[model samples]
Target: MNRTSNPGDNQTGTSQRPFRVTEDELERALRETLAGRVAAPQPLAADPAAVALRRARRSGRRRALSGLALAGVATVLVTAGMAQLGEPGGNHGTPTVVLGDPRGFSPAPLPTATAPAPGPVRAELDLILGSRLETSGGEQQELTNVGPVERAQRLPDAGGWLMTSATPAGRTLWWLPPNGSPPQVLLAGADAVAVAANGRQVAWRDGPDLHAAGLVGGQLIAANQTPAPAGAEPVGFAGDAVLIRQPGRGGFATWSRSAGARPGPTAPNVLAVYGELPDGRVVGLVAAGKPGRPCVALLDPARDLSPVRTGCGPELAVDGLGAISWDQRWLLLNGAGKAALLIDLRTLGTTVTAHPAGPPVVAGVAWTQTGVAMHVDATGGLVRVRPDRVLDGERPTASTIDGVAPADRPVVVADAGA
Candidate 1:
């Protein structure tokens, strides 16, 4: 029997192509065979070359599939990484991971938000006169014309003005509202009046009786009376208590709704009480003897009137004329000389001596709502002295307030109510 040689046989017994099939047709046939739509017919006898060829084709197909699968996995990983990096157009930059020494690594603190500081208080200038009061803005109101006004002060809350003037009948305490309302007589024979720094309570002395009342809507209500020592005058309010200056005694006494009357600060050297600080401390003058050199002292009423701090100097020879800033951080003292001293209570030693221009006379001194220390010179010029800059030991310069005449005295309207 004669056997025909197979065309697929090679010298090395490897596979050889007997007929050509395009790549598309082979791929289709492979798909159809896997899907079971086409049957792969088996030969009665298997050819070695044909079997090897099929095995090689399968190996190549598997390799191609593996490469494609790896590429797909790489693409998926790259897309996920970009998504975690956030949007493209942002402030974010490339991420960097630092592996620092365990002992030196410290995470940065997160940022925080803060509220803005409030603006300065709004104040007005009152041109006080014997029979009338005029504001710098041209508002006018007539006064009782009780002989030249003796004492006048803007309420701590700027609710109104408190004035004490002499009448033929006797000394009278008057209240003038800021709205140009008619003057209201608080006490006909009122000896001394004191209003709390908060502008809520008022205390006045009428003869031997001490009167206390609540101030609401420019009216006095819930009146309370207690018998006090004759000639005792109210100086200020200590919480809900009235601080009274004893006539014979040099120290002060306290009277409240709960406590009728009680002895106050036993300290014998306290000569005068200027005002109350925001912290309830009283700023006063302390001296050893009459006409003796006086010192600025902070007396704590809560501590049995103990002296917290004291500052003394020739410039602090206040002639019983001074004004404390609304914040109680500054004290302006008009000395015996032409200059006035501005003292920073925070540092009792820091002082600034302000001299007026045009004349050596400093008629009066006050603190404006804007924190400026103002004084009227003999020329009636409104001299403004800032405490902040002068507190640094620098020479203070004065600026004249426009539209104020040399004969007119300008007083700042205290707007502490807000």
Candidate 2:
């Protein structure tokens, strides 16, 4: 619970300096610090597993606190480890928000100005039928009363969402809140590209320009008009910088608000970038074929030119952002036939969790308060999984969710005390 402001905020002058930090500096500092020292670390006072869980729970808070300022846009950073004091007569359990319908959702009072929640993650599914945003076993609703959309991202705060709809001319970006307010248009472009977001800011590609704005209000705060190299596309936002990658490039290059574009760390034969981990590691999928195994190496963001390849296997289908666990340890990969692979980063081990009687395809995966969950594409249900059991090579039982199909592009959103 200890909070400290940056040194720049402590200047004694009439004119106050803006609080600014960048991903490059942080990465470089981490690299140099690790390189110059090799000392024994202090032992934890609690159970190691408990410590890991605590750190996993606090990852959201750290990322929010680590937000950087860009182009005078004041970033909204929230701490995640606050006490969950409930309201009288309020349901603190999971709540769902549906899209593509005129059903109204009342705006509940936000959490007591704390960080986003860590457990019971909320999610939205962008499917072929329409866009459905909801919680596990909660009420289902459509994203909007408008036409079907291809892409949608749930805000980190879980209060709103950003959606892209395609037309005969081009694509348009729209922001919708949970309070049943009318959808507001952010912009329209020839092509609606990838969008990345942290707690406070959201950065997306509109035609050739990269636009960033507040996650809550969806106001246009910053735009990057510099044309990307030929086929490069934006993957995510690191601090205040945009992470972009070319089609065949193995690594990512960062674009900052001040320093136009600079090369970032690269991996060998990278297929996709799953955004930055809470600990600042850039997770990606690397080619690691074993005959017909169809394996891939999982690389964490590195402090050096080479990234640490933690795990590899055919089950490690790095579906980019959606298949990651909250702690960054477990990866929900596509299993051989009709199962999902759950890889443990700590042990570098892989386990296949398959249902004896259910769907054959695992579409999406996320971490919930109780355990891990995956959307079964065949049966259109959500299955709860046990990481510990799966890692133990046991036939882990899955609780199937009814009425919900596997999401095309499923995203986990932590319910921020609403």
Candidate 3:
């Protein structure tokens, strides 16, 4: 990090100035940190797949470090990145957000959207810890008896919410009914949980096995548990299957009750797997060039995870905190401490718009029936970004939801269809 002094500093007797960290500098620091932290343990040498496992651990560490660094500088980076994107001949109609110098590689243009643009829908924000709901009618109501929760998501069809809380034993997953009943324990010692887009199916990793069940009457039904790879974390749901990132693996894998678990598709240079489309296509960030410039690509699962479309720009360099809209038409990713990158998936990889929302996206992003909503660090209130407005060449802006106060932690849209 470096600071630039103001010209009138001497007169004011103030030496402090704004700090800036270049993309190259950030990348250098990240590589150095990973080099020291990702060294393979000597005890694993006897394993036949020791080398492969080491590589997997290294990749995971890099992703984790990248996210931490991005969160620290999110406000600064987003401010600078947005200024650049707002410049003439920048992203007004163009499809990318290029920061600093441009790399020579250009991707072929993909097909544009053929269907009518989606209309905006009424959405509400749920202040998780605050235990309040900001309704569509601009009114607030108490969300009774929901205690301190670390992570939570609304169930499909307003079935209620799935939440996780820390306990003396470990972490506990609880199901809170929509009718104001007490929370029920869904799973104990659960690590990472993934809820299906339709909300009928849920999967989670508990210790050495993966467990999944159907959501019926606010209970987990048809519960099934299966063995999973060590250090496997459920990321998202790909239709009926659970998408997982296994340590020491090249890409991602899918686990299902009937099919068990197996590698689906992957690439050599992928750094992080964000989410999957309803049809099982995967979206992830890929590193290229000497310093590892990142690009986002839409991968076809049927074609060995080959990229169907790819887009590279400075804005694509992110810390890996991201979410894909339920409709599979948008991607909201954390920028490297500078801005948040929102990609229009309809373009297949070409269009990327930058929003200065900072990073470590509160309780994750929520997708309304026709738009997107989430809280950003820059704006203490809930921010909404409509896909149709961005497509119409409007710069995305943040407006506070009526009757909702700014929240410091984990505020998400409740019945917004996520």
Find the candidate with the highest lDDT and give its number.
Answer: 1
| Candidate 2 lDDT, 208-293, residue by residue in tens | 56555545566666554555555566666656666666566344566665536444544445655554556666655655444423
Cα lDDT of candidate 3 equals 0.63
Position 359, candidate 1: lDDT: 25
What are the TM-scores, per candidate, against the unseen true structure?
0.57, 0.53, 0.58
As for lDDT, the candidate ahead, 1 or 3, is 1
lDDT ranking, high to low: 1, 3, 2
| Candidate 3 Cα errors over 4 Å, as ranges | 1-123, 133-146, 247-251, 259-268, 288-291, 302-306, 349-363, 378-380, 387-408, 414-418
Q: Compute the lDDT of residue 321 as modeled in candidate 3.
A: 65
Give the per-residue lDDT of model 1 (tens digit) for 1-418: 6555776656434346566799999999998778774365556586999899999999788767766776666577666667766767644333332232323458564445557754322225564643667664676687754444555666654578866666776677778887877888877767777666566777887777788898776788888888877577787787776777866546666676554555454555666677788787888877733466677788787775666876665545534566688777887776556566666677665233343222232544556667876555555454566776665555444445554445444444333344
RMSD per model, one decimal: 19.9, 41.6, 40.2
lDDT against the true structure, each candidate = 0.64, 0.51, 0.63
Cα deviation at 95, candidate 2, in Å, is 43
Cα distance off (Å), candidate 1, residue 388? 4.0
TM-score of 2: 0.53
The number of clashing residue pairs in each candidate reads 1, 16, 6
Best by TM-score: 3
